[model samples]
Target: MVKTAKKNKIHEQLTPKTVVIKIAKWFLILFFGIYTLFPLVWLFVTSLKTNAEYFDNPFSLPAVIQFQNYVNAFSQANLGRMIINSITVSVIATFINIMAAAMASYAISRFQFKGKEAIFAMFSAGVMVPLNALMVPYFTIFSRAGLLDSLNSLRILYAAIGLPMSVFIVRGFMDSFPREIEEAAYVDGCGFYGRFLRIVLPLTKTGLVTAATFQFLTCWNEFVYANLLTSSPATKTIQIGIRYFTNQFTTDYVSMYAAIVIAIIPSIIGYMLFQEQIISGLTSGAVKG
Candidate 1:
């Protein structure tokens, strides 16, 4: 029996079924890799081509690399200011979003109260609310509040808009957290605030980071509300500023591509930084919830 078991184990990976599965797995990986990366590669390549080169053959290699497109995007298009605006708004909004979500999620997950489930349901239900439908009322409210064209309005709106998803992710993690640690902390001369700030917050870092990354990206990439809210160049985000290259008569394709590449870099950087936490948060939530 032992020898037969050993033989089967040894031959398991060499079986036709196993070999076919291995090939299929790698084939899917290669296909997805190219699918996801090709557009980015094409964007970077096109950003280096001149207008004439792009007009001649977009897919072909550039005859001479046009570094000037980046320069023009920064100087002529004022992409630098827009990028800074995007960073500022996204960072502040993400902080606000995550903080509110953490508190709300903690309360919803760990504490029992009247209407708690209802409130949680409300927050979760917010994910179904359409931004487009609310634009008119939101515009009216912001206008009445004297917040139109203001970055603060954008920050607050971005935070509010991302709140539901943040709460959803953070609550999943918080629910999975063992309560014994909090109970222990409570018995050890720790107050409610201390238990939350020191014990719960520290342990929930992965969930917080995952939620923050999603919130930050949402704030960073959001366009329709941004365009609707801000008209001034100083207040415009990187998304709205990307359209400066286009008009009725002509479009600066290469420079637009350069600005796009610039805009994408920060998001990529952010994802890379929190990728591990995000992955852990997702898997842990799935397994534990």
Candidate 2:
């Protein structure tokens, strides 16, 4: 009876401490959540404020909602074309990057050939190289090939830049999958393409989605190559197009804020939708022995 009473007392003491720890965890999450979301809230607020209200009464509430800012942003900068161009480039680059990386990762992960380890190591070393040094060579090659000032140039560059990282991620996920799965497909008379497309691809959907999301976001946000490669307004992406908000005379804060809010919406929606898959893919096989 004494022992039972002591055990109960110890458990009761631990319960409050556990509850306090949980509260602390939640409080920390709330703090970071508000901290992260505050900028987005401010962008929306600034978009709603008029130029006069923004300058004259900077801290005061907006006297009137300004719907024209969004309209002007779309019409003045030809942002509609820019959005379309960005969408096309991001989608094309992401598809090529994910598919090519998946194939390369599968080969490196599954197959055993002579000098394979050396080749894989070489590929891995690319992850450490800085992109800035490659810009001159890229410019020269694209110019010589007559690909400059074209959408194809943007797509190719985005895919090339994103490939090494995607390869690393897809290879990691592929390593976690069992070889027996592919062998079973082979037993069913599946060839290399069939085994890869039917057996391997389905299992790696989470990893592929994560890779594609990352590639899409990277391509969409890329500005240096876009600004350097494209000359015409039709080929310009939203990131480059946003520069129009800063003309030589004065910057249009209201229009710029609205455009930024608009541009961020698509990426946020995509990430939220694939949040679970991305988390799982990123952490699947880091501890394998």
Candidate 3:
């Protein structure tokens, strides 16, 4: 009788959540999952429909797939060129962003200097500043310097803007790292760059990949700044190319959907390829921390 009472008592404490609460939690998750996935499902459906069919039955599946829309989207809009341009810009920006943020984060985490806390505070403060507010001044400066409308110019700007947040994230991850590894490497005659390149970087590879992936996505899909800065066809990115299918009076929804599907290809591939890295980095930070 005493053992039974004790077992009952333990069960009471462990099973705090009632059946009704569990049911409600599952319902909430199901609702959110559908809400998030519905748009992507709609996009694929729309891409397969003709313009008339798309407008007439936005929710309905196509009777016959209009695969020509994909062909037209690329050929008519010169999306191939835009894809190449976006890839180049994104790759360059991602490289610069990851390198700058990684070095800055490592320095801030490991080194001791005067005003160190104040400098870290300044960097933290920069995260709260809105990029939109600085656009006017940035435009004026870039204009005077004759860097506006150039691919290299835009890359530098994107990397600079992305740096503050990237540094904070990387620094947060680096903070959880033990100092003994770095100290041991130092003892073994590894200088700052040597230790960083050979030891620190290998250990933080997942975090670096996460940062680079985000930077690539941002650089590739960035429309507002790219549209605002570059007016020439040669320098325009995929986002700009996608906009060509839309106008004031008439909009080619089929073509637009096709373009969107095409644009998603690279990002999807990137995510799939680096998913393991992202998962590992996030899980390590959450669980190990």
**Pairs in clash, predicted candidate 1:** none
Q: What's every prediction's RMSD, in angstroms?
A: 1.8, 2.8, 3.3
Error of 2 at 131 (Å): 1.8
lDDT of 3 at 285: 63
Best by lDDT: 1
C-alpha lDDT values of all predictions: 0.92, 0.88, 0.86
Candidate 1 worst ten-residue window by lDDT: 280-289
Model 2 over residues 172-230: C-alpha lDDT tens digits?
88988899988888888999999889888999888899889999999988889999999
Where does model 2 exceed 4 Å of error? 1-23, 57-59, 287-289
Clashes of each: 0, 0, 0
Candidates 2 and 3: which is better by lDDT? 2
Give the runs in model 1 whose Cα sits over 4 Å from its true position: 1-10
lDDT of 1 by residue, 1-289 (tens): 9999999898997899999999999999999999999999999999999999999988989988899999989987798889989999999999999999999999999878999999999999999999888999889989999999999999999999899999999999899889999999888989999998999999999999999999999999999999999999889999998899999999999999999999989999999988999999988878863
Greater-TM-score candidate between 1 and 3: 1
| Worst window of 10 by summed lDDT in candidate 3 | 280-289
